[model samples]
Target: MELFFTSLLNGVTYGLLLFMLSSGLTLIFSMMGVLNFAHASFYMLGAYFGYVISSYVGFYPALLLAPLAVGAIGALIERYGMRRAHASGHLAELLFTFGLAFLIEEVVHLVWGKSPVPYRVPPSLDGPLFTLFSATFPTYKAFMMAVSVGMLAALYALLTRTRVGLLVQAALSKPDMVEALGHNVPRLFMLVFGGGVGLAALAGVIGGNAFVTEPGMAAAVGSIVFVVVVVGGLGSITGAFVASLAIGILQTFAVAVDYKLPFFDRVTVSQTAPVLPYLIMVLMLIARPRGLMGTRET
Candidate 1:
């Protein structure tokens, strides 16, 4: 029972982290109609950037400023690179992002080397915060949960309660209509794209230390983010959130269980836990071709 509760807490924290990454990708894809292959690369960049910034200024400042820096880079990419690719077509845009992902990886290697950096939770947040059911929860993990929920709340408020939010939703489906109303649709697109990537970067800053920080960190988690987006529904933030938490909990609980399949006695269930997300994704694809919350494509 203690083990079950402990795994539950871990799963929730992990799920919230996945939401941080998936939310940004969902927003970018929904608004721009682009599957950003490079989104995870931005996450890797955030970790590297946060590590550097934290070394000099401390984790608090890195947490505050790293996302802003990453967002600015995303905005520039939209303006100079993606915008040009958009003019050519979706294929061109996807190819551009694919190449950009590699470029970011190479840049990370050049700047930070291929080794995992020493990115640790801040000393202030390193200790256990509380105990439940004979299980101790780390202060850092709780902090992550709070930050994730706060970001989720802030995003919801921005979109549902503010003029900018309305304009953003309008821009997603009716860019031309918004443009006709004297709004700058292209600039809004840039801002949305940038903001989305920035959110990913923020996830990296928090998740890097929680997981591992290395040149391959993006590739390590990149596919899962896409899976979350697809299972939840492409271009659906709410869907992404649901998928993220579900996957996180599913994976965490799978790891905690020790059982063997009737047919596959050679492999422990924990050994196969890594494949659970892909399995869920396959089932989702079969059951709902349009995704849990996605609209039918014409």
Candidate 2:
């Protein structure tokens, strides 16, 4: 029972981290109708940039500046690169991002090399916050959870409360109508894209320390982030949040359980744990084609 509770807590924390990544992707997809293949590359950039900036200015400042720098780059890509591709078609946009992913990886290797950088948790959050049933919970994980929750709340408010949020929502449904009302739809698209990338970078800033910060980290996490978005629903932030938590807990608990089935008596459940998320995704597609919270309208 204690083990179950401990794994539950770990899973929730991991899920929240996944939410931090998936939320941004969902937002971009919702607004632009584009599945950003390079979103995780921006995340890797965040981790690498944060490591370098934090080494000089400290983690707190890196937390602020790294995302801003990445957001600017994303804005530039949208204005100059993605905008042109948009004219060519959605396929062009996707291929552009797909190529950009490799470009970012190559640049990462050029600048930081192919090894994991020393992106350790800051000393202030390096110790355990509390212990339960002989299981220690790290302060850093708690901090990560708090940040994810806070961002979730902030994003919810921005979309539901503010005038810009209202406009963005309106634009999502009727870009032409919103443009007719004298709003700059293109500029809004750029802002939303940049903001989404900023969110991804923020995730990278924290997640890099939580896991590993290597050139290949983006590729490692990119597919999972997409699965979370797909399972939760393409355009639903609420769905993404719920799905992230589910996957997080599912993966963590799966790793803790050891079982031997009749046909595969020699193979432990843990041995196949890595494929569990994919299995869940396949089931989701079969059962709920539009996703748990996704609308067929999307």
Candidate 3:
């Protein structure tokens, strides 16, 4: 019972982290119809920016400034780089983002080198929040959960209750009509793209210290973000939320289990934890390509 309860908490924490990272990608895809391969790179940039900014001022300031910096960069990319690529077609845009990911990784190597930086959790949130059985949950993890939930709430309210959201949603399905109504559709795309990447950077600001701050961190989570997005359904924020928690809990419990499969005696459940999400993705594709709670077909 103790193990189950503890694992459940840890799993939810990890799942929420995944949601934070993937939500940005979901928003970008849903609003702009662009896959954004470089999305996780922005997340990596956020962590590094947070590290540098926090080193100079503090974590709280970095928490605010880092995402803003990343968001600006994203907007610029959309304006200068992606805007030009958009003229060619969706394939061009996809290729542009795919190459952009490599460029960002190389830039990281040039600036920060390959070594992991000292991006520790803030001293204020370094201790335990509460104990379950013999296990103690870290305050930082609780802070992460709070931030993730808060972000979800804020995003929900912004999209459903604001004029800006209505315009953005209008642009998504009827760009021409929105433009005919006198809104700058192109600028709207830039903002949506920027906002999406900004969300990714925000995740980095919080997650970098909780995990590690390294150039390779983007690659580590990039694939999983896609899996979550796809498993939850492409362009579905609610689906992403559900999938994030599900995958988070699934992987967390898998790590703690020791059972072996009937045929694969050599592999324990714990050993398969790394590939479980991908396996789920494959199974999901086979079973229901549209994804859980997803409105569009994959």
Candidate 4:
């Protein structure tokens, strides 16, 4: 019982973290039809930025400042680099971003070295939040869950209840029409890209200390994020949310179990946990290519 409950909690927490990262990618794709290959690089930047800012000021201020700094960088990238690539087509955009990922990684190596930085959780949230049947859940994990939920709520309200959201949605489906109405469609695209990466950075700010803060962190979670995005549906926020939690729980439980497969008796479930998300993605694509809550076919 204790293991089950602990795994469940851990799964949800991990899933929400995935959502925090995926939501930004979903927004950018849904709004601009641009799949950012360098999205995880921005996430890595967030953690490093948060670490530096927090060291100087504190976690609270770093929480706000790091994302803003990354967002501004994202805006500049979109304006100068991505904007030019957009004219050349999707392949150009993809190649640009793919190369940008390597560039960011090299920069991190140059700046922070190859070693993992000592990015610890805030002292205030350092201890266990509660105990369940001898299994203690960390306060930082609870804090992560709260932030993830809060972000979801805020994003929902922004898209559904605000004028800016309406414009964003309008621009998504009808960019020319929005531009005809005097809206700067190109500028909107820049903001959408910036905001998308900002969310990724926000995830990095929180997740870096929760997990590890290293230069390779982006590469580590980068593929899983795309799995979440694809499994949740290409451009569906709700689909992403559902997929994140499902994958989170599935992998968490798999790590806890030791059952062997029928034919592969040498491989335990725990040993296979690392491959679970990709396996699920493959199965999802085969069974329902549109994804759980996705509106369009992939």
Candidate with the greatest TM-score versus the true structure: 3
Once all C-alphas are superposed, what RMSD does model 1 give against the true structure?
A: 1.4
Would you list the clashing residue pairs of candidate 3? none
Model 4 segments more than 4 A misplaced = none
TM-score of 1: 0.96
Task: List runs of model 3 lying over 4 Å from the truth.
Answer: none
Greater-TM-score candidate between 1 and 2: 2
Q: Model 2: what TM-score?
A: 0.97
Range of the 10 consecutive residues with the lowest summed lDDT in candidate 2: 289-298
**Candidate 3 lDDT over residue span 1-298, tens digit each:** 8888988998999999999999999999988999999999999999999999999999999999999999999999999999999999999999999999999999999999999999999999999888888888899999999999888888778788999999998999999999999999999999999899889999999999999999999999989999999999998888999999999999999999999977997999999998999999999999999898777785
Best by lDDT: 3
lDDT of each: 0.89, 0.92, 0.93, 0.92
Error of 1 at 188 (Å): 0.2
| lDDT winner between candidates 1 and 3 | 3
Mind giving the per-residue lDDT tens digits that candidate 1 earns over 207-264? 9998899999999988999899999888777788888899899999999878986799
Which regions of candidate 2 deviate over 4 angstroms?
none
